[model samples]
Target: MDIFSNHKRLFLLVILLFGTLTVFVAIFPALNNQYSYEPLPDSIPLTEIEQRGKMVYIGNGCVACHTQQVRNVEIDKVWGSRPNVAADYAGIERTNFWVNTATLMGTERTGPDLTNIGKRQPSEDWHLTHLYQPRAVVENSVMAPYPWLFELKDSIKITEKDKIVNLPARYIKDKSKKVVATEDAIALVAYLKSLQQVKLPDGTPSPEFLYKREQKKHGANESGGSSALDGAELYTNYCASCHQTDGKGVSGAFPPLDGSAIVQGIDPTSMVNIIMYGYNAREEYGEMPAIGQINDLSLEELVALMNHERTSWSNDAPEVSLEEINKILEELKKQNENQ
Candidate 1:
C-alpha cells in the first residue's frame, strides 16, 4: 500500500515538472523571440501625442492584422528586406513610462507586415489621407478607416461678457451636433509615426533611389524612341507573366519594377550587369535566368528595351546608352569564359 501511494505522488510531480519545462522552453521562445523587433538607428523621438496614439493602437487591436517582422529569404524577397531583430524594440524602453511597453514582438502575420511602414511612406499627410479612406489612396488597401479619430468642431463663438454658449453649427455636426476628434484617434496616429525602420549607416540607399521610377519620365518628350519601345515589347513578352503587365507584381514573389527605385534609380551599369550576367544571390528571388542567351537582342536593342521599361508605363527613368550595354556584354563574356 505504501509503495503504491509513493508511485502516485511521483507521477504527479513528473507531470508538473514536464509542464513547467514546456512552458519555459517551448512556449516562451515561440511567443517572445519568433519575430524579434529591431529599432532603426537615428530614429526621431516620439512626441507625447505619438505615445498616446500607441495606446489607441493597443486598444483597437491593430496588431491583430499587421505583423512587425520581415524574414530574410522566403519572405524578404516579397517584402524587400530581412526580418527584424531584437534591437528594433529598444526604442520602446526610452518612451513608455508604463509597464506594458509598446513592443510588437509577435510571430503571425495575418495581414501585410508593418516592419518598415514609416520608410515605405514618409508623408504624414499621406498617412492622414490614408486613414481617412484607404481606398482613396490605394485602390486595393484592405484597411478600414477610423473616422472617429479626427476632431470635428463647430465655429468658435465669443460673447461680449466673455461667456460663450450655443456654438455655431460649423463647430459641430450639421445634423447631429456631435463633435468628433476623439483622443484615441490622435494617439493612434502618434503610434503609427513611431513605427519607422532603422537604417544602417552605410547600407541605406540614397533619397534618389527612393523615388518611384514612374516619376522620372516627366522631363523627356521624344515619343518614337525605338529602344524603349522594343524593351517594353520584350518585357511584355518575357517578363509580364511573373512581373504582371502593369508591373505591380504579385505580392510575396516578383517585386514591382514599374515603380521600383532599385530598377530605375540604381546605376545603369548595375542594371545592365543584372540583365546580362543574371543574379543568383540568395538575397533576391530564384535566380533570374540568363535570358540574354536565348533572346539574341543586340547591345543597342537591349539598352533600348531596358530604358523603355524604365521609363514606360508609369515609370520615368532616364534612357540607357548602348555603350553601357556593350560594356555589360563584355563583362558577361569575361565572366562566362572564367566559369
Candidate 2:
C-alpha cells in the first residue's frame, strides 16, 4: 500500500514487470527461433529483380488479399504439398533496415495462398495479364486492375524490347494500342514467381497435413473403379483458376479446352504429356505449367482429369483408362532417364 502511494516507485515497478514479461514471453522465444532455425537446403535467395518486385508487392498491398503461408490442414493441401515450418521463413530477410515485413504470412486469405504460386502458375504472360486486369483472365474476379504497371503504346517501337500483352478485344479499348508491362510489373511477376516452396533435403521427412478429409469419388466411368479420384473436383481446384468452369479459357490468354483438338483428340498421349510436361504456345496463348508433375497426381487422378477434359464441354472423346495412363507414364519415365 505504501509503495502504491509512491507514484515514482509504482511507475518504475510497472515498467520493470512489463519489460520482464516481454523479454521472457516474447523477445526470448523470437530470438531463439531466429538463431535456431535455418532455411531448407533447397531454398534460394531472391534475385535483385525479385527483391524489387517484393517491394512492389508490399507497396501494392498484395498481402491484404493474398496469403504467403500454407497452414497444416487438409483444406490447405491445394496450396502446398506439406505444412509450413519455421525454416520455410528462415531465409526471408527484412525488406530494409527501417521496414521488415519480409515474413508476410498475412492474417487472412481473401485470395488464394501464394506460398507455391511460382510452381502453380509459372507463366509470366498469364501473371502480367492478370495484373493488368484480373478479370481479363479470371472472370468475376474482385481484384482491381493495376493499369499503372503497364503502358499502352500505339505500336511497339523498333528499340522496344519490353514484352507485349495481347488483351481481349473487349478489354482493349483500342486495338491498335499494345499493352506493355513496365519494369515494375515485370519485377512484381518475378517476385511472385519466386514464391515457391523450397523442398527439404533428401531423407528429410516432410510434415504431414492434419485432419485429412475423406474425398468421395467423382463417380465411376465405364472403365474406372470407385477408387478413381474426382476429376471434376481436381479440375476445379487446379484448372478452374485459369480455365473457367465453362471450359472456355480466357481468350488470347488461356487456350480453351472446350473445343481444343488436343482435349478431343482420338489419342490421349498428347493430352497426358501436355498435362505432365506443360505446354508453351507463347505466340498463341500463355504457357501452361506442368500441373501433374507439380502435384504428383496419381494414375487415378490422371485418368479422371483426362476423362473430365474429354467428356466435358460437349467435347466427345475416348476416355483414358488407368492402364493406358500408367503405360504412358512408364514411357515418359524411361524417356526422362534416357535424356
Best by TM-score: 2
Lowest-lDDT window of 10 residues in candidate 2?
217-226
For model 1, how does the per-residue alpha-carbon lDDT over 77-184 read when each residue is reduced to its tens digit? 333244455565655653435466556645666656666655343334345545655544455778887666664444353223221112223322463432333556
Best by lDDT: 2
Off by over 4 Å in 2: 1-11, 158-160, 199-211, 218-220, 224-226, 330-339
Query: Which 10 residues in a row give candidate 1 its minimum summed lDDT?
Result: 159-168
Residue 8, candidate 2: alpha-carbon lDDT:
97
Candidate 1: segments with Cα more than 4 A from true spot: 1-47, 74-80, 90-102, 105-110, 155-183, 201-339
Which pairs of residues have clashing backbones in candidate 2? Answer: none
